[model samples]
Target chain A: MSEIVLSMKGVEKVFGAFRALGPLDLDLRAGERLGIIGPNGSGKTTLINCITGVYRPDRGSIHFQGRDISHIEAHRRARLGISRSFQIPRPFNGMTVLENLLVPLDYCHIDGSKEERARSVLTSVGLAGRISHPSESLSQLELRKLELARALVGDPKVLIADEAMAGLSEGEIDEVLAILLALNRSGVAVIMIEHIMHAVMRFSERIVCFETGRLIASGTSAEIAENPLVRRVYFGE
Target chain B: MFSIDILLNAIVTGILLGSVYASLALGLAITFGILHIPNIAHPTLVVAGAFFVYTLAQWGLDPIVAAVIGLVPFYVLGLALYLFYSRVFERRGGANVLQSLTLFFGLSLVVEILLVLSFGSELKSVNVSYIGSSLKFGALTVPYRLLIPALLGPVMIAAVWLYLSRTNSGTAIRAVAHEERALSIAGLDPAAVKRHAFGIATATAVVAGAALIMIGPVEPFGGRFQIGRVFAIVVLAGMGSIPGNLVIAIVIGVAEALVASYLNPSWSPGVAFAILLLGLAFRPQGLFGAAR
Candidate 1:
C-alpha cells in the first residue's frame, strides 16, 4: 500500500443501547479519492465525527500521518490538516466572500499574508470575481464554492465533502466535481460522503459501503456497484 | 409655554445623555446583540463596576483611571462567567431563551445583593472637579461631567468596531455566534471566542460604570432602572450593528429628553420601549441589521 495518511482500526461507537459504528478498519492513501456510501443512519456521520474529533470513538484508534489523533479536539485536527464541509452549506453569513475565507486563514497558523492567501483560494475556487460579495448574495453554486474554499483555506491534508452536491443541478455538480478533482490533484486526500450514485462512482477510485455502522463492502466503484450486499442495502432484497 | 432655550437645553441634554446610554449599551451590543447570550445581568455588572470605581475614587483616584484599572479584572470575571454559562448550557447543546433569561436574571440579582453587602444600599457618587461645573453657550447649558463621559461612548464604540471589523480574533468573535462550526473548521474553539467576546463586553462595564457614577450617584439597585432601556437600545439598533447602537441610542435619548422636557419625566422611561416597539413593527431585522 501507498503510505496511509489516515488509519482507523476497530473503531466503534455506541449510544446508550445502539452501536452507531465500528469494530471496523479503513485506510486512505495520501492524495487518494475515496467515496463513502451508506443509507441514512448507517453511521457515516458517526465515523466522520470520530475522525474529525467531534466525538470520541469509545473504542479503537485513528492514526493520521503516523501519529494517533483519536483524542484531539476538532479545531486542532483542522490545524493538523483534517477539514470538512457540512452537508448543508454553512458559509459564515453577513461576511463578504473574502471575509469568509479569512476566518480559516486567520486561525490556520498558515504563514503568509492572510489577504493574499484568501484572495488566492477564492481565485482557485473560481470565486475571485465575487471576492467582496456578501455570503448571502451568492447563488447555490457559489455558496457551495465558498464552503469548499473554506475547507481549502486550511490547506488540509484530508478534505471531507459531506453531501456537498445535495441540491446542486447536474451542471453545478460537474463544476464542484471539477474543483474537488483539481484539489485532489494538488495532493489533498478527498473523502466524498455522497449519496449521488453516478457522481460518487465517477469520482472515487475506491468506494466503501456502510450498513448499520459496519463496513459491508469495500472495493473499486465497479466492485461496489456489483456487490450483492450493497445492492440489497441500497436498492432492495 | 415651551421655551426655545429650555428646548435647546433639553435637546443638548438628550444628546449628552444619549452618549451615556451608548456607553451603557455598547457592551450589550456585543453580549446580547452579537453572541445572543441575553445577558440580563449586564446592567448589574455596570453597577459593580461603578462600586469598584467608587472604592478607588475614595482614595482620590480619577473615575476614568479606576475604570482603566478594573478592566482586566472585569474581563477575567466575564471569562469566568462565560465559561460557567457555556458549561451549563452550550455544552449541553444550546441555551434556550428562557434558560438564559433565568440564568442572567439570577446573576443580576446575585450581583445586586453582593453590591448591597459590600457597599450598602446607599447612593454613592464620585467627586471630580469637572462634575460640579456646567458650560454655557448660546442658551444651552452643558455639564462637563456629561460632556466628558459622553465622549467615552463614541470612543469605546469606535475602538470596538475597529477591532471587530479589522482584526483576526475580532472576525472570529463575529463568526462564532453565526456559524460556530465554521469557527471550529477555522481551527478556533468557539467557546474561547465567545468567552473572549464576553470578556470584552464585561470589560466595558467598568468604563460605563465610571460614566454612570459621573452622571449622578448610583445605588446597588441603580442598574434595575436601566435594564429595560438598554435591552431596548440593543434591539432597536439591530443586533450586531455597532454604529446602529449609537444612532438608536441617541434617538431614544433625544426622545426621552424631549419627553421629560415637554411631557412628564416619569413618562421618559417609556420612550425607549415605545420606539423599540414601533421600530420592530417597521424594520424587524433592525434599523441597520441584515435580514435573517
Candidate 2:
C-alpha cells in the first residue's frame, strides 16, 4: 500500500463568523492524483489555503510526510516540499522567465546549479525558448506554464494546482495536463482543484466534491461521476 | 549677461550636483521606488548619516572612509527602522497608505528633533584635505570636494544596480515587491526580503551623507530642502530603475543649476517639480517603468 503523504484530521477554518472550511478529514496517498471540485466559494480554495499555510486552520492538525505542519509559515511549507500554482497566474513582472524560476530555486535551496535547474524546469514545461523573454510579454498559455514551472522548480512532494488551466483552450489545456501528468509520473502527488469538468474528470484518479464547506463526495472518477450528493451540488437536481 | 564660461560652469556644476542628488535619492529609489513604501523619512536619515560621518571625522578620519565604515551600522539602523515601521504600521492590522505616509512624515520630524537635541542645530562639515582644491580644465574648473562626492553617486548606484540585477538574493528583492505571495509560494519570506532591501536603502544614506558634507555644510533640518528633489527623482526615474534614477537626478540638477545661475537661486528649488510634472504629463508610468 502507498504511504499517506499528507493527512488532514478534522480541520476547520473560520473567518469573521463565516465557516470557510472543515471539521473535515482528507488524505492524499504518495504519488496520488486527486481532483477537488465544487461550485465557487464552496471551500476548495479555503482547504488548499489551509494546507499551504496561507491561513492557519482555526482548529485541526495537518501532517505532511508524518510531520505536523499546521502552524508553519507559507514559505516553510513550500521548502518542505508542499507547493502550489495560483489560479490567476501571478508571474513576477519586470523579470525574465528564467529569473522567475530562480526565485523558487534560490529560496528552496534546491541541491543544484540553480541556473541549470531553472533551465531544466523551463525545458520540462516547454518554456525553454522563452527563458530570456520578459514575464509580462508571455502569452496566457506561457504564463500558466511559467506558473507551473515555478511551482515545480521546488521539486515538491505534493503539488496543489489551483485552477491552473482556467483560461486555456482545449489544445492549451492538453499541453498543461501533459506537464502535470509528467510531473506525477516522476513520483509527486498532485491535488488538482479545477472547475473544468472534462479536465478534472480525466486527470484525477480519485475525485472529491465539496458543498458549503463540507466534503460532499469522495471516490474513484467513475464512482464520483455517479454520486448523488455530488450530482445535487453540481446540477442542483 | 550670459558668459560662455558661466554657462559651461553651470552645466558642469549641474552634472556634478546631479550626481550628488542621485546618491541622496538612491535610498529612496529602493524604499519608495521599488518597495513603494513612501519613506519620507529618508532625507532625515541621510542627515543622520552625515552626523555619523561628522562624529567620525571629529576623531580625524576621512569622511569617505567614515561613511564606508558607517555602512553596516546604517544598514542595521535601516533594519531596525523597517522593523519598527513594519510592526507599528504593517503588522498592526495593516495600516492604510495615508497612515503609513503620516507615520513616515512624523518619523522624519522626530529624527530631525533628535538630531537637533544631539548636535545643537549647528551646521556640520567634514575637514577633508581635498576641500580646498579644484581640478582646472582649459576653460573650466571643478572642485574636488564636489567631484569626489559626486562620483560616489554613480559608483554606489552601479554597485547597487549590479547587485540587484545579478545576485540570487537580489532577484528575490526585485520579485518580492510585485509577486509577494508568489515569492512566499516559491519558499521565500517576503518580509525578510523587504527588510534586507530597506537595510540596503538605509545604508546608502551614510554614503549620501558623506557626499552632502563634502558638497556643503549640513544642519539637523538640512533634509527639509532635499525632500522635494529626491522624491521627484524617484518618481521621474520610474519606480525601480537604478540607471533612470541617475539620469533624472542629473536633468533636475542641470535645470536647477541653470535656473540658479540665470534667474534667482530661489527658482532652482522648483525646477525638479516642474520637470517632474512635465515628465509625468507625458510618461505617467515614469520614463523607465513598464506600463502596468
Candidate 3:
C-alpha cells in the first residue's frame, strides 16, 4: 500500500444547530488522485475547510504524515505542504499576476529566488506571457489557471482543488484537467472537490460521494457509478 | 483681487505646510489605510513621539537623530498593541470594527493623560540653531524649520514606497489588507504580518513627531486639533497610496495657505475638510486609488 499522506479519523464539524460534516474517516495516499463529489450544500466545502484548517473539526483527529495536526493553524498546515484553491478565486487585486505568485513563494519562505520561482510557476500554468499584467484584467479561464497556479506554487504534497473548473467552458475545463493530470504525474497528490461528474470520474483513481455531510459510497469510478445509493442520492433515481 | 507676489508666497508656503501634513499623515496611512486597523490613537501617538524627541533633545541630540533612536521602542510598542488587539477582538470574530475603534479611542485618551502627567502638559519646543534661520531665494523666503520638515516628507515617502513595492515582507503587508485567508493559504500568519505592519506604522510616528515639533511647539493635547486634518489627508490620498498621500497633503496645504491669505486665517482649518468632501463627491477612489 502507498504511504498515506493525510488521514482523518472520525472527524466532525457542526455549525450552530446543524452538523455540517462527519463522524467520518478518510485517507489520501501519496501521489493519489482522489475526487469528492456531492450535491450543493452536501458538506463538500465543510470537509475541505476541515482539512485545510479553516474550521477545526469539532471531534476526532486529523493526522498528516502520521502526526496529529488537528489543532494546527491553517497557515502552519499550508507550510507543512497542504494547499487549496478557493471555489471563487480570491486573487489579490492591485497586484500583477507575477506578484500574486510571488506572495505565496515569499510567505512560504521557499528557498531560491522568488522571481525565478514565480516565473517558473507562471510558466507551468501557461501564464508566463501575462506575468506583468494586472490580475484584475485576467479572463475567467486565466483566473482559474491563476488560482491553480497559486495553490501549486508552494509545491504542496496534497492540493485540494475546490471547484477549480466550476464556471469554465468545455475547452477550458479540459485545459485545467490536463494541468491537474500533469501535476499528478509529477508526484503531487490531489483531492478534487467538484460538482462536474464526468471530469471527476475521469480524473479520480478513487471516488467518494457525500449526501447531507455523510459519506454514502466510496469506490472506483465504475463501482461508484453502479452504486445504487450514490445514484439515488445524486440523481434522485 | 489676489496680488501675484502674495499668491506665489502663499503657494510656496502651502507646499511647505503640505509636506509637514504628509509626514503627520504617513503613519495613519499605514495603520488605517493599508492595515484597515482604524487606529484612532495614531495622532496621540504622534504627540507622544514629540515628547520622546523633546526628552531626547535635552541630551543635545538633534530631533531627527533622536527620532531615529526612538523608532525601535515605538515599533516594539506597536507590535505588542497589535498582538493584544488581535487576541481580544480580531480572533474572536465579534464586534471587531466598533470594538477596535473604542479600544484605540481609549488608548488615545490614556496616552494623552500619560503625556500630560509626565511632561506637565506645558507646551514643548525643540531648539536648534537652524530653526531660527530662513532661506531667501529672490522674492521667496522659506523658513529653515519648515523646509527641513518638508524635505523629510518626500524622503520618508520614497523609502516607504520602495519598501512596499520591492521587498517580500512589504508585499505580504500589502496583501494582508485585501485577504487574510489568502495570506494564510500562502503559508504566512496573517496576525504576524499585521503586527509587523503595525510596528512599521508606529515607528513612523517618531519621525512624524520630530517634524511636528520642528514646525512648532507641541503639547499633550496638541494632536487633538490635528485629528481631523491628518485623517482628511489619508482619505484624500486614497487610503494606502504612499506617494498619493504626499500629493494630496500638498494640495490641501496650498488650499489652506491660500485660504489663510485671501479668505480668513481661521477658515484654513476647514479647508482640508472642504476639499475632502468635494474630492469624495467626485472621484471617491481618491486621486491614485484604483477603482474597486
Candidate 4:
C-alpha cells in the first residue's frame, strides 16, 4: 500500500541462447528494506544488472519514479538516483581513501564545495582518519566500508547493495549491517541481495526468493520461512 | 678528465635539453599515463601538433600562442577519436588489449601517412627572434633556443598540475584512469569522462608541438623516433601524475644530455629505454604512483 518507488514489469534477460533472468515482475516501495535471496546462479546479480542498466533486459520494461528507464545508460541511471555496488569489492586501487571519496563528491556534483563534503562523507562512513591512506592497503572490512561509502556519496534515492557483505567476517558483517540499517533509517530504499539468511532476516522486513530466474516467493520474513516452496528450494527435501 | 668548465656546461645543457624532452613527452604523460590508453601514437600527435604550429607560424602568429589557440580544436578532435574508439572496440566487451594496440598502431600509421601527404614529408622548423639567441652567465652559455623551450616545461606542468588538483573536472579525469566503474556510481557517464580526458591529453599535444618546432625541425615521421622516449617519461613519472612527469622528463633529459656529451650522441636514443627498464625494476608503479 506504500507508494511504489520502482516497478519492474515482466522483465526478461538472456545471454545468447541461455536465459539468465526474468520474465518477472516486482515492485519496491518507499523506505523499504527488501532482501533478495537466491542460490549462486539463480540470477540475483543479473536482475540487479538489468535494473541498474548494466544489461538491457531482452523483454519488458523498468519504471523508476514513473519513467521508462529501460534504454538509459548505466551512468545516467546512477545520475537519476539508482546505484549498485558490485558483488566483488572494487575500491579504486590507485587512489587514497580520501581521494576516492572526493571522486564521487566531484562527479555527482552533490555539493558545491567538494573538499568539505568529501571530508564529511568520509567521517560519516567512519573513515575520517584513514583518509590519506592508500585504498589498496585497506583491510577487508575497511574495503567494504569504502564500498558502502561510495554508494552513499551519490545521495541515491534507491541503493542496490549486491552482496556487499560477502567475504566479510561475522563481526564485519554486523558492522556493515549496522551501516545499512542506518542508511535505511535515513529514508533511502535499499535492495539487499544477500545469501546469508540470518542477516537478511534480521535486516529485511520483506523478502523475495528466486529459483532459475523466476520469482519463487515474496512475503514477510516469518511467512517466507513458513512457505513450502522456500523450504524445497533451500533444503531440497 | 672532465673539467670544471665542461661539467658546468654539461649540467647547464642537460637542463636545457631536458626541457625539450619534457615538452615532447608531456602529451604522452597525459594520454598514456592518465588515461591508460597506451597511445603509442602520442608522439606522432605531438608532431602533428607541431605542424599545426608551423602552419600558423607561417601565417606570422607566435608559435606559443598558436599552440595555445590550437588546444580547443584538438580537444574536440580527441573527443571524437575516443568516442570512435569506444564504439568500435570498448563497446564490444573490449577486444583484448593487444587488439586495441593494433587499432592504435594502425591509426598511427594512417595519421603518419596523412601527414606525409599533406606536408610532403619535409622537415619544418619555426623562426623567431629568440630562436637564434643565447644567454651567458659567467662560464655557462645557454642557447636562447634551449632557454625558451626549456621554460615551457615548468610553466605547462604547473598549469596542468593546478587543473588536475584544483578543479572538479580534473578529479574526474584522474578517477577515470583508476576505477572507471566508480565514475558510474558517482552519476557521471564513464564514456564522457574518458572523452574529456582524451581531449585534455590531445590539447597538450599542441603545446608540445610548439616546443618541438621551437627546438628543432620536425617531419611527419619524426614521431616514430620519439615513441620510446615519450613512453619512458610517462611510465617513469607514474601514470597520471602530471607534475611528476616534469621531474622525470628532466632526469631523462639530463641523462640523455650526459650520454650525448660524454659517451656518444648516437646512444642518446637508448637513454629513455635504459632508464625505463631500471625504473620498472625498482618501482614498477613509477616514481610517484600509488603502490597497488
Clashes in model 1: which pairs? Answer: none
Interface RMSD of each: 1.0, 0.6, 0.9, 1.8
Local error of candidate 2 at residue A87 (angstroms): 0.7
What TM-score does each of the candidates earn? 0.97, 0.98, 0.98, 0.94
Model 2 chain A: which ten-residue window has the lowest total lDDT?
A103-112
Against the correct fold, how does model 3 do in TM-score?
A: 0.98
> For residues B122-156, what per-residue lDDT tens digits would candidate 4 score against the true structure?
89999998679888888888887778878987888
Candidate 3 local lDDT, A1-237, one digit each (tens): 789999999999999999999889999999999999988888999998888888999999999989898999999999999999998889988889988888888756667887888899889989999999999999988999999999999899999999999988889889999999999999999999998899999999999999899898999999999999999987789
Give DockQ for candidates 1 onward, in order. Answer: 0.78, 0.89, 0.81, 0.65
Docking model 1 quality class: medium
> Which sections of candidate 2 miss by over 4 Å?
none
Residue A171 lDDT, candidate 3, scale 0-100: 90
When sorted by DockQ, best at the front, the candidate numbers are: 2, 3, 1, 4
Clashes by residue pair, model 4: A11-A23
* Candidates, ranked, lDDT: 2, 1, 3, 4
Q: Look at candidate 1 and tell me the lDDT of residue B212.
A: 97
lDDT values of the candidates?
Answer: 0.92, 0.93, 0.91, 0.84
lDDT of 4 by residue, A1-237 (tens): 768889999999999888889889999998899999988788898999898888889999999999999989888888788877777778876668877777766656554776767777678778888888988889877887888888888788899988888888898899889989999999899999998888999999999999999999999999988889999999885
lDDT by residue for model 2 (B116-230), tens = 9999999988887878799999789999999999999999999999999999889999998798888998999988999999999999999999999988899999999999999
Instruction: For candidate 2, please provide the TM-score of chain A on its own.
Output: 0.98
> Can you write out model 1's per-residue Cα lDDT over A103-213, one digit (the tens) per residue?
888766667788999999889989999999989999989988999999999899999999999999999999999999999999999999999999999999999999999
The root-mean-square deviation over C-alpha atoms between each candidate and the true structure, in angstroms, is: 1.5, 1.0, 1.1, 2.0
Q: What range of 10 consecutive residues in model 2 chain B has the weakest lDDT sum?
A: B88-97
- Per-residue C-alpha lDDT of model 2 across residues A54-172, encoded as one tens digit per residue: 88999999999999999999999999999999999999988999999988888665675989999999999999999999999999999999999999998999999999999889999
